[model samples]
Target chain A: MSSIHEITLMLNGDPVEAAVAAHTLLVDFLRDSHALRGVKRSCDMQVCGACTVLVDGRPVSSCTMLAVDADGASVVTIEGLGGPDGLDPVQEAFLEHGALQCGFCTPGFILATKALLATNPSPSREEIVHHLSGNICRCTGYQKIIEAVESLAR
Target chain B: MLPRPFTYHRPTSLDEAVTLMARHVDDVSPYAGGTELLLAMKMHFADYEHLVDLKRISELRAVKRNGGTLSIGALATHAAIAADAAIQGSLPALAGLCGSIANARVRAAGTIGGNLCFAEPRADPPVLLAALDAQLCLISARGERHVAASQFITGALETVRAPDEILLRIDIPLTARSTRYERVVHGHRTVAGAAAVIAQDAHAAPRVWLGCVATHPVALPNAEAHVAANPGVLDNALTQAIASDIARLDIADDEDASADYRRHLATTVAIRAITATVEQEERA
Candidate 1:
């Protein structure tokens, strides 16, 4: 096996470095090495958006990204989407709209919504559906999730 | 599933990146966002011994517009393209296509060059680029070359991109013609496939490109020629030939969809796309 490589990046407002295998996924590095388990690993593929995170203020599936590729980039996990003390409006909207059942896909959904609403403050309903089309949630059937994003748009 | 172990090299300069790729050749995989490549690697679909990370190469991340053409750096993400005012003003079809790609997360990380270079049959950009007649610029230690979008892709998951070459920029020429895109995505199921139709009424004939059809993006030349030749007979003949050609096309069908259904969807989407393009042109 190839030797591990050291990568440095800004993680949720903190500068962190880790020696990860060249092929180590960003989600695994976050969950295991950095201990920021808020970014869940579900399908471990790009199909399911459970592992989404913000790379330079844009949401991306971390499972589909290598840790070393994130060098000098800024990443924001679900934990970075504000906390119990002060929640982001998107997260609050998700809560208000009951967007989660088991909550396995909540983090990805919240972060994806954050990225969307950031660029488009008041997107139409069709725009919401189009923007969130890539994310799959078996538990919620996507109605509440759409509602959550819609509520935020309003 | 994790990707196979490989050495990582993050080059800050495009020249250095090109040199690294030229040196490594087939062993090095140049990754932009890794949205598709990393997933394919995890699925064991691809194996490379080295990865030349292009995210650190700042030169490849710019989007500039000159007189008559827009030069978009290969590393510019889909989100960047979709939000770019120049793209929105000049090529609204491209902007709409960018916004309509997978989703926000995928758009954020996915680069236009990466998506085009990956050459996935279901990707949205190839069909739009083909209709737009976009030019793909490739660079390597040897030299640089430009290939039209239609010639860039040879087959499914295949491109003319040499192993030693790096995609530099995509040049889109400005034309007076209007363009539009329409796609029918099966939204009920998890793996429901999509059929996208791109049409541009530029010169005499309206060029149409169909996605999710054949191994690569398929151009409807016969239909386009018919429309161009007989500008007055715009209704049944054009639709019939195009639909028939689409039905006879040989495309891969997995368990999620059937060849017949894809053909039907392709014809329907193509017709809709053409109708939309014509309607927009008439209004303009």
Candidate 2:
């Protein structure tokens, strides 16, 4: 029988308690269990960064991570990045730079940018491209995404 | 897609984790980061009845330097290694290689030990680690043993690690060297990875290692001999020697590239790595 794990995580700023199957993915736990539609599931494989989320402030592919792995750790999805008063600075930068086309890859890009800016606020264009290599966008071709991240870097 | 259902075991200590793995034996897998193993499980390529998660064991999450050797915990994330002060100060080439892995998320989620244990030929760590002459510490209920990096990986997706053993850490000799890693990738996966390490001492012989194009990391002895024989020189004869050197290896065939193309790439990549390392050494 599959074991049922009772896990507690700091989701965003709040504590969330869940009883999940040991194999439940962090992406599924957030989308199906918590209704956070912002975490998209594009490539179930670990390649695509659409399922990216920050566990304890480290960006990881939620599709590749077990929900139980984050037990007792802090997880921040795109929805959690928004402030009570307004959108996150990364979201604002994306908007100002028109960084979205289909909008499917925006959350992942935003979260990745948030992680990048958090650690390196003034990354060069090459550094930005290197850091964002995990994310893929068919519509934008990443020009505006680069601009968005570059603007934030400035 | 969700991975196949399995009982999860989160052991807070390495001893307990080893005991659990030993009890389950062939039916169990030591889960760390879950990037590669989970992918195989989800794709139905491999499966396990029990997964022993080792994240809670904090002892294996450190980077320490004692004497002439530097020890990096098995659980150290690629991103952690890339940003680690010790690694950056001692082996910037390795730090750069770690930074240039699959992507940001993978770097954040993947562990050095997990990478070596998985023994993915296309992965980046093993080749450079092998060139650096790193050693992996394997521990279990039967005590512990340290295996040289070159011997740790036996083949593609295979290692010398026993079912009951858990890789504890990776230790690298702490000596300054002119090192460079070169790789070509398509989409999200690597096509080829090659590395060159020249000891800081001008007369110290250099070593070359290549990956992804082979079932295991291939060290080129003829190429190293060529470089050592002709210091501060790169020419057609050197290229010919490198080509002949890697031609002896048994390269692998994947959908991305054929064995022939990989062999060709091996020559170019090895030359590129050696040339870059030599230039950097001269500049330094």
Question: Taking the tens digit of each residue's C-alpha lDDT, what string does model 1 give over B221-260?
Answer: 7777765676435588878978776766776676656877
Residue pairs whose backbone atoms clash in candidate 2: none
Candidate 2, superposed: residue stretches over 4 Å from native:
B200-204
| DockQ of every candidate | 0.66, 0.83
Report residue A126 deviation for candidate 2 (angstroms): 2.0
- Ten residues in sequence with the least summed lDDT for candidate 1 chain B: B188-197
Please name the candidate that would achieve the greatest lDDT relative to the true structure. Answer: 2
Please list the Cα RMSD from the true structure of every candidate, rounded to 1 decimal place: 2.9, 1.6
What does the lDDT read for residue B266 in candidate 2? Answer: 79
- Model 2 Cα lDDT, one tens digit per residue, B1-284: 66889999999988789889999997988898888999988887888999999988999899998888889999998999999998898889889888888888988888999999999878889999999889889988889998999888889899999987899999998664788899888777788889999886767778888888878887888888988898778999889888887778877677889888888887888889999988987898
For model 2, how does the per-residue alpha-carbon lDDT over A97-123 read when each residue is reduced to its tens digit?
A: 889988998889999998998899899
